[model samples]
Target: MPVLRVHLDSDRSTARRVLQLHQEGKIHHESREAAREQVWRRGHTPAGDPTFVGITNGRRHVQLLYDVEVYSDTVL
Candidate 1:
């Protein structure tokens, strides 16, 4: 898969929305180290090692590092 540099969005609101999705269960909470390994599951299974989610993106890293808590993730 082609890597997506999602940190391109500088709007804080957009990042906040992602956090809302996680809280509302619309999205699953993964981790911030996606640039090192696959971080999401495809489809809507919600039953596995990694949680299922929609389109796979680098949001997990951003979410972990910013919206949710203080953390570090490998830069893409």
Candidate 2:
């Protein structure tokens, strides 16, 4: 955690997606591990609610926290 710094990508598109997910029950308040995996697997995670992004400070890859979650019923 010491090497990682999270700066949320606040875009209108991302926020709009989050709102839609919430309304459609696509977003879930799940564990951070899954959220982490989703972002870590891809350099940039899916943007929704709290958007995802990665910043590398030299050799260190910043791990962004997914404050919101998506449903498991459907594949993201």
Who wins the lDDT comparison?
A: 2
The sequence of per-residue lDDT tens digits that candidate 2 reaches over residues 1-76 is 1122234333444445545565675653332345655544544443444433322232333332344333333333
Assess every candidate by TM-score: 0.27, 0.27
User: How far is 28's C-alpha from truth in model 2 (Å)?
Assistant: 9.3
In model 2, residue pairs whose N, Cα or C atoms come closer than 3 Å (at least 3 residues apart or on different chains), thus clashing, are none
lDDT of 1 by residue, 1-76 (tens): 1232212222345456655676687653333234123322211212123332222345443323322121233233
Superposition error at 45 for model 1 (Å): 20
True-structure lDDT of candidate 1: 0.34
Per-residue error (Å), model 2, residue 53: 17
Residue 11 alpha-carbon offset, candidate 1, angstroms = 2.3
Candidate 2: stretches off by over 4 Å:
1-7, 28-76
